[model samples]
Structures are given as structure tokens and as C-alpha cells.
Target: MVWLTMFYLSSMIFLAFFSFFCLLSSFFSILFDVSYFIEWDILGINSNFLVMTLILDWMSLMFMSFVSFIASMVLFYSGGYMSGDVNINRFIYLVLAFVLSMIFLIISPNLVSILLGWDGLGLVSYVLVIYYQNEKSANAGMLTALSNRIGDVAILLAISIFGYYGGWNFYFYTDLIEEDSFKILVTLIILAAMTKSAQIPFSAWLPAAMAAPTPVSALVHSSTLVTAGVYLLIRFSAALEGSAAQTTLLLISSLTMFMAGLGANFEYDLKKIIALSTLSQLGVMMSILSLGYPNLAFFHLLSHALFKALLFMCAGAVIHNMKDYQDIRLMGSLVNQMPLTTFCLNLANLALCGMPFLAGFYSKDLILEIALMSSINMIIFFLYFIATGLTVCYTFRLIYYTLTGDYNLHSLSSVTDESYIMTSPMLSLGVGAIFGGALLSWLIFPTPYMICMSLFMKTLALSVSIMGGVLGYLFNFMVVNYSLNSLYFFNYIIYVGSMWFMPFLSTYPTSKSILVMGSMYTKVSDFGWSEFYGGQGIYKVSMSVSNSLQLVQNNSFKVYMLSFIIWVVMIYICI
Candidate 1:
């Protein structure tokens, strides 16, 4: 009891300090408006400044508020949720580090500063993912780090390209790059952002991240971390505008949105479903921002953080109460056991479904309108609309399996209600889901209705919600295998077998060319993954060649001395 008390107080105090920074940033940004930032001039170019000087703008302020509130609530809630656990101190410390890193990231003014925060965030999050230090969590941490490392390599290549030819005109600076070499660099930057944001083909690891603890998931999925891709896009909007990478961004963003939404529906682990849902939503935000409506992406990101954090925490609470069995099929009628958690979960799901009255509605509507306005292709419009439909379906699935289905307590009826520490964050985040849209009115479209949008978008969004609720409810009572669908086998083959093994195989598979003594053409033709049988040939050739070099190293000194003596004799005779 004494240990628990001491840990909670210390955590609360640490949380208070971090929350203060988030609040202070928002408060100052609002008070100062747009111009009140620390503009840094490094390398003779103006850059962003969050470390030394941070200027809070409308977008940063809003997100900072959401981030801080959730940070505090999560800290407070985790105090109770993890109260008696031995890992409590370790968890709280990482939470503090995570929030601080995000604050620096939010307020940082330049690419260098933001990248520093981005890297720190990646580290602490990996640590947090493996907080349980279990085998599953450790694997999740490695996958997350591996993805981030790919993003890092892309970033380094971009930086090199940017620096070699004048550095000032690239994305971080207010100036745009018109030079050919710099244009190539900027293209690499887009690749980095896509990988970091986990778009389309790169998005597989997010589902794997479900092995993390719930609070870690809430923090990562919601505000600062996963949206790092969209955040980078928005932060560097001036650079991407009318750039060469638009076509690439457009296609990948569209694919990410559609694929991730489908992946969400195909998941049964409540956390994995939410994880995929976030990837899909981030995909939507990336697509919208690619069209240069960053404000809308920022808008959706805000609501997404709040509402998704709520759902994750609520899901966590349910798991906590039920002793950590996370299968949704085992979680029917939790409404009776925990009424507050149920209500909070419903509010979050409503927001996620983008019910016209909730927080997600405004953001989702704005992004679609922007997509239509910016895109010339009707195919893009249709793709986004279909993704919206899937979003609704998955959100409702989460709601039904956790709350209103038949009570299948299965001898687990004695689960207790969540404490104040666990549920308070859900309650706070729930309020945001309820009323955050009007507060974030800066992002709302001034035009009430549009011909291309109103009829199809509203009709589709509403129909999706209704159909999703009905279907998820109808199927809630049935016992079914909720594992991967028909494509799971295929997905495992490509994403698991191919991706995991390709890096290790790419080099030696072609080293067969090293062996063949025939002409280069004949050897090149023979090269493949042939168990390096040809590599053995190369090994023999290498042995012969290396022996030749060794003979030189061993005999070169004596040969050079004899040559010198002969040269001296020749010089004397010539003289």
C-alpha cells in the first residue's frame, strides 16, 4: 500500500509538469496568434524552432491541447490501472519521456529539431511496447523499430541529397527547390514520409503492434506518434505543393486508405482492429493532405487522437477487468459489468463511425470535400467513399462485440468495475468525442452543402453507419472463427515470408556470379538463389586470387629492395 501510494504521487507530479507544457503551448499560441514563434536561422537559412524557440500556431495549439489532456488522463488513469503492478514506476517514467518528446516535436520549428524529437519518440515507444518485456511485446517492439529504421534511412538519403546541393531551398526552409538535384532529393523525402506514415504496403507492422500494452497503444495511435507521417506532410506542405511526387502520393495514399480499412474489418483482436482503423484513418489524412488541404488532415488527426485514444483505453479497461483475454468474441455484454466503460466506448465508437453529430463527422466530411475539389479523377473519389463505408463497418463491429451482445461471461462474471484511474481518461476523451468539433471550428467548412458531396457523402456515411450497426448486432451472438479471411494465407506469404526473408536473401542469391569463370555474360545469366553452389566456385577463385595477393604482400619487400639495388648499380654505370 505504501509503495503504491508513493508511486502514484510521483507519477501525478511528473504528469503535471508535462501537461503544463502542452497547455502552455496552446495558451501562448492562442494569445499570440500566428507570429509568436522562435524562427531559427541556421546554415544561413530560416528554420523551425521548438527546442530553443517554438511558435504556436492554430493547428499546433489545438493538437497540443488534445495531446496534453490525454497525456494527463492517461497518466492519471494508469496510476490506478497499474497500481499494484511492479512495472508501475517504469511505465510512468516512459510515459513522461513519451509526452515530453511529443511536446518538443509539436513545438519544434525546424526539420533538425523535429527529426530529433521524432527519433526520441521512436526509441521510447519501442521501450513502451516491450514494457511487459514479454516475448510477444518484444517482437512487436522490433517490428516497430524496423519500420522506423527504414524511414530513417530514407530521411538520411534525403538529407544528403539536400545538403550536397544548396541546403536552404528544401522542405525545412521557407524557400522552394527548383533545382534538378534538389527535386530528386525531395522525391526521396516523400518515400520517407510514406514509409513512416505506414502507407499501404508499409502498413503491415501496425497490426503487429497490438502486442503493446493498452496505454502505449492509446498514446501512439492517438496524437503525436502514428500521425508522424501526416504531421511531416503538413509541416512540409509548402514543399510538396505542385511537386513531382504528387502522383506517387496520390496512388499510395488511396491504396493505404482502402487496404487498411479492409484490414480493420478482418481483425478480431480488439486492439488490432483499432490499430488497423488508425492506419486507414491516417491513410485518409495523408491523401487529403496530399491534395494540399493540410488543415483538414490536421483536423481529422485531432479528432482521431481523442476518439481513438478513448476506444483503446476503454478496450484496455475491458481487458483489464476481464483479466486480459482480448478476444472480442469472449467479451459479450460487458455493458452489465461496467456501465460507464460501455457508455464511454459507445461515445468513442460513435465518433469513430463519424456520426453526423460527432467529432469525426466534421473532419471526415472536410477531407472528402477537399479530395473532390482537388482531384480530377473520379476513381479517387470512389475509392475514398468506399473506404468511408468500411470505416463505418469496422467501428460498429468494435461496438457490438464489446457491449450489447449476449452475456457470455463464461464463469468470469465476477470481474470488477474499473477504478477512477482507469476510467477517467476514457471519460475525458469521451467528452472530446462528444463536443470537440465545435471547439475546433477553424477546420469546419464554411460552406454548409455541395452538390458533388452532400448527396453521396451524407447518404453513404449514414447508410454505412446504419448497415454496420445492424450487421454487427445481428452477427454478435453467432460463434464464428474471427481469424484472417481468405487472403490471410496470401498476406502471410507475401508480408511475412517475402518481406522478412528478402533482405537476408537479396545479396547471396546473386553472389553466384562471383563463381563462374566463363565470360561475364555467361556468369550473369547463371546467377540466382542456387544455394551458392556457384558461390563455392567463387570461393575457389577467391582462394586463388587471395593467395596471389598474399604472395605479393610476402615477397613485395624483398623484390623492392633488389630492384632498388639494381637501380643504384644502373645509376653508377650511367654516371
Candidate 2:
């Protein structure tokens, strides 16, 4: 086990360095407007062909570098967090596989290879989510897997439709494909992206998947699984420009942002709050993508990956020392006890709120500014504003509840930054959270955004951010004796805190009918008809023949001979 851990750490460190070099090379490629596509004619069938295509551009390389870096940090952090587990090697192996799948998805520009990576992510994530071997993990894994299967089916449908183009690769023909002819394919692909990214209607799985180990959550929410959808959209943006599906995505993503932000404020579980925040950030990415700013969206995607990963590591550290207690209401006054972790947490949270100069600020603030300048509907504008505010609101609320209040846990509860393996990753990501935004902003966009909004619109982001902070502090700390015990409040709590019944809608109505039909089939066909025709009927017929044959044999030689003669006569008549 020690050797295994060392091997993983060494492998990740090597990969991280390799990715950094690749990133630098990609930047040069983008500088010269050089993009390369490598294709191999793997198989051909009649008029259709299956090609394995890889695209090397700034976007793919940069995103791949980020994924590799974050994954390396996660693997190092998991060594300490998962050290006590009996199946540590298994966990490490799965995480390695998860990273590989993300790499496959990152480079592929063809539908076939994308699906290969896409399904790999879904399958591996399901396994990771259920790693704990508990009922909750089981339920969460099922919901997660089943929810993502919708997207898988959608992508398969898209591949069938893309066959009309004579190949499954979109990068070569994305600009040439006519909007009218490929509208359905675009819509299906969008649906697949939404499912993978956990947009509205499929948003339930993101939070439920938090049942996995914290490192898995960090990877899934930060860079790999959820981001796959955003990356797909970025690749397919040319086909979707000005399409109805894109317009619909804008509305749905905005609503998703608002809903997730509100739900985070209502949630008490530490991991779920962070999970909801990821959902909201995903909404921000999708909304920007829908508005035809794929570059900005990709920038934010990279920036978010840094801080979110750090945030999860900090949360994992806190959870570790607190004996796995995840309820924020029960945590308090950790600044002195674990000052470094508290610092990391605060920095990551600030970054999440898009504080100026932080990683999130470069991407998030710019996104909001661009949205303000664009000619968008009033609803989307407000959704973007309110959702931005809610981001800060819930973040501040989380800070107050978990970091500054009185010590609320048992006397023996241990809280300290004693583990270097865990704290090292947090520190690494914290640096990125602070500096990554400026670096990526400059790298991705050499030309600054030119905006001409009025003063009021200019301060809209800052104004709402301040308001959200005040509201979060007031609501979580100042408000006391507020109860959800009453009938009305209880219902509202379920509706808001449970994400507007999305979990129920995604799981209950569909699962209930399917389970009922399954039970009916088991009783009627499997047990009843199958038992009779397959087992019981055969046994009864065999018994009857054996009994008659025994009676004929026992009667006597003469009787036996007569019976044989009669049987021969009957056979002759039948023949």
C-alpha cells in the first residue's frame, strides 16, 4: 500500500509537468492561429465511415492541462484522506481511470470517441459515488447513473442523426453544416450536454453524487464529469448559434443558476452546499455559452476548476477532523484551531463569489459584464444578476455558520491541520484561486472586452454582491427561532431546499411506475407463467408418464406386451 501510494504520487507529478509543457505549446499554437486535426481511417462500411479524430487547439490543450493539474492534486490529497480505508488501492485506481476518461473526452472531436469517454465518465462516476458500500451511496449511485443515461441515449441519437453527414466527426464540418438540416442533432446534443452538466431537470444527480468520497466530489464537480457537458457545448457552439435550442438553453440555464443558488442557502449539509454551488456555477457557464460566448465560458470553466477543487479539499479536511460530521450548523470557531485550512476555505469562497482579482473574478465578473452589455431578455438579465448575488449570499452564509460561530461540537472533537498530504493540495489550489484568474484571462483573451453599459449596469455585479453578503449574514446568523415546523414552512422548506422538487421529479414519478411494473412482471410472468410452463408443467407431465409406465410394467408380462402392442398401434395411427 505504501508503494502504491508513492507510485500514484510520482505518476501524477510527472503528468502534471508534462501537461504544463503541453499548455505552453498550445498557447504558442493559438498565438499563431494554428489548429491541428489528426484523423485515422479506422473502419469503413459502405458509404459511411468511422474515423478516430483528435483536435489540438488552445481550448483542448488548456482545459486538458487544467484537468491534469487538478487531478494530480486530488490524487495527492486522497492519499491522506483515504489512507485509513481498506480499499485504498481500489480507490486510487478508480481515480486514475477517472482522469484518463476526462483526457479522452478532452481531445476527441468526433462523436464516437466522445461517447466512449462520455460513457466512461458516467460509469466510473457511478462506481465512485457508491464506493462507501452504504444504502445512501447505493441510492445516490443509482440516481446518478440513471440520470446520466438519459444523456447517453441522447448522444447515441445524435450519432445516428450525424450519419447524414457521412461521418460522426463534427469539428471538420461544424461550420459547414446547415442550421436547418441539423437542427434536431443540435438539440439532441444540447440535451446530452445538459444532462452531463446537470442543468435543470437533471440537476438532482449533482448533489446526490456528493455521497462519494470528497476527492471524487472535488474532481467531478470541479473539472471532469460536469465540465464535459460545457466542453461539448463549446465544441458544438458553431452549429447552435442563433438556434431555438440555444435560446431555450439560455432560459433553462438561467433558471438553473437561480434555483441552485437559492437551494444552497437552504441546505445545511456541508458537502451539499458546495455541490449546489457547483450546480450554480455550471449554470453560469451554460448561460454564457448559450449567449454565444464560448470563449468566456471556457475561461470561467478553467477558473472555477481551481477554486472549487480547493474548496472541496478544505471541506474534506474539516470533515476529517470533525469525525465526518458534515452539518454546518454544528460547526463553529475553527480559525485558531485550524488557521491554514480556514484561510484556504475563505480564499476559495471569496473566489467563488467573484471577488476582484481572484480566479473567479476574471471569468465570472467578465461574464456578468458581458451579459449586461448583450441584447438579452429581461428575465435572463435578472436571473444572471440574482444568481450572482445568491452565489455570494450562500457563500457568506456558509462562512458564518462554519467558521466564525462558537464551538458547537463535542469537547473531544479534534480539529487541526496535522496532515500534510491534505493541506498541501489545499495550499496549492489556494494559490491558483488567488492568481489563476488574472493569468488565464490574459492567456485566453489577449484583447480585453469593450463594454459600454451605464454606471448603474456597471455596478450591478458589485451592488448585488454586497447585498448578497449582507443578506447571507443577516439570514443565517441574526435570524433566530425561525422554524420550519409549521405545515406551510415545512412544505416550503422541502420545495426550496430540495431544489424545487427536482429530486422527486427525477426519481419518484419515473421510478415508482417502473418498479410497480417490474413487480407485476415478476409475479405474473417470471414466477407464475414461467414456473408453470417451464418447471411445474414439465414436472407434472413427466410424473404422469412415469406413473403410467410403472403401472404398465407392474401389471405383468402379458399386460406389458399388450400395452406395447397398443402403443405401437397408436404410433402407427398417428404417423
Can you give the TM-score per candidate against the true fold? 0.78, 0.92
lDDT of each: 0.72, 0.91
* Model 2, position 345: C-alpha lDDT score: 97
Model 2 residue 108 lDDT score? 96
Q: lDDT tens string, model 1, 1-575?
A: 68756775676665656556655665565556544566544444444212244656766766666676777777777776776677677787788788778877777655556667778888887888777778888866777787777777776776566555444223245354666775676676677677667775567567667777788788889986787777777877777778868767877888777777766665668888888788878888888877877777887888788898898898888888877888787888777789998888888888887877688887886676667656448778767877887787777777777787667667736765648778766777788898887566543443454536567654665675677667655554454434455355665544432333332343233355543444464645556433255776778889999997777578678877987999999999999
Worst 10 residues of 2 by lDDT: 477-486
Q: What is the lDDT of residue 541 in candidate 2?
A: 98
In candidate 2, which residue pairs clash?
Answer: none
Report the lDDT tens digits of candidate 2 across residue range 325-441. 999988999897899999999999999998998999989989998888788988998899999899999999999888997789898877889899999989989999999999998
Pairs of residues clashing in candidate 1 = 37-55, 48-109, 48-110, 49-109, 50-108, 50-109, 77-421, 515-538
